[model samples]
Target: MAYTDDEILAGLAEIINEETGLETDAVQLDKTFTDDLDIDSLSMMTIAVTAEEKFGVKIPDEEVKNLVTVNDAVTYIKNAQS
Candidate 1:
């Protein structure tokens, strides 16, 4: 079954929160992963890997650059699943 956007967002939230040690409530769609969440390049890659596994989608290295916010990741996974 395909996952809903909310489910994808929640999954990304968990990954971001775990990787960055940030509160889940602080993770919002509009928030910038780097500026708002303080996610470094290395940590970003880690989140990407975890997201790929959790969402069952492959996030290419080049595409990783485009995922700058929580919304971006959630959208990508939702679309990829479809």
Candidate 2:
């Protein structure tokens, strides 16, 4: 099923929480994965892989550069679902 942006964000929150051990509230749309979430390149790759598996959307490496913030990743997933 296709997901909305909010659903994508929530899924991402779960993934981030699992990977980073962060609180659900800490994974907000405005939070940057690198700066705010302290997600390094390796962690980001793991998140991206989890996201791909969960969302059933292929997020290519080239497209990963565009996902700087939580909102960016959610939007990318939503767009990909469409």
Candidate 3:
């Protein structure tokens, strides 16, 4: 089954928490994935890996680099699902 936006967000949240040692509640959609969430380039690669493994989708590095916030990832997943 295709995942919902909430599911995508949750997946990203789990990845963030795992890589950054932060809880899901600490992540906000508007928060910058790097500056606000303290995610570095390497951590984002890890997040992309998690997303690919968990969702069975390969996230392009170009696409990943465009992600500035949790909402960016959410939108990408939703669009990919479409």
Q: What lDDT does each candidate get?
A: 0.87, 0.91, 0.84
Candidate 1 per-residue lDDT, tens place, 1-82, comes to: 5899888877788888888879888889999988998899889999999988887888998999898888988888888885
The candidate that wins on TM-score is 2
* Predicted model with the maximum lDDT: 2
Q: Give the lDDT ranking, best first.
A: 2, 1, 3
Candidate 3, 1-82: lDDT as tens digits: 5888888888888888889898998777788887888889998998888887888776898888998988888888777763
- The clash tally of candidate 1 reads 0
Q: Report the poorest 10 consecutive residues by lDDT, candidate 1.
A: 5-14
List the candidate 3 regions with Cα displacement exceeding 4 Å. Answer: none
Per-residue error for 42 in candidate 1, Å, reads 0.6
Instruction: List the candidate numbers ranked by TM-score, top first.
Output: 2, 1, 3
* Residue clash pairs of candidate 3: none
What is the alpha-carbon RMSD of candidate 1 to the true structure? Answer: 0.9
Better of 1 and 3 by TM-score: 1
Give the alpha carbon lDDT tens digit for every residue of 1-82 in model 2: 9998888888999999999899988999999999998999988989999999999999998888779999999988988884
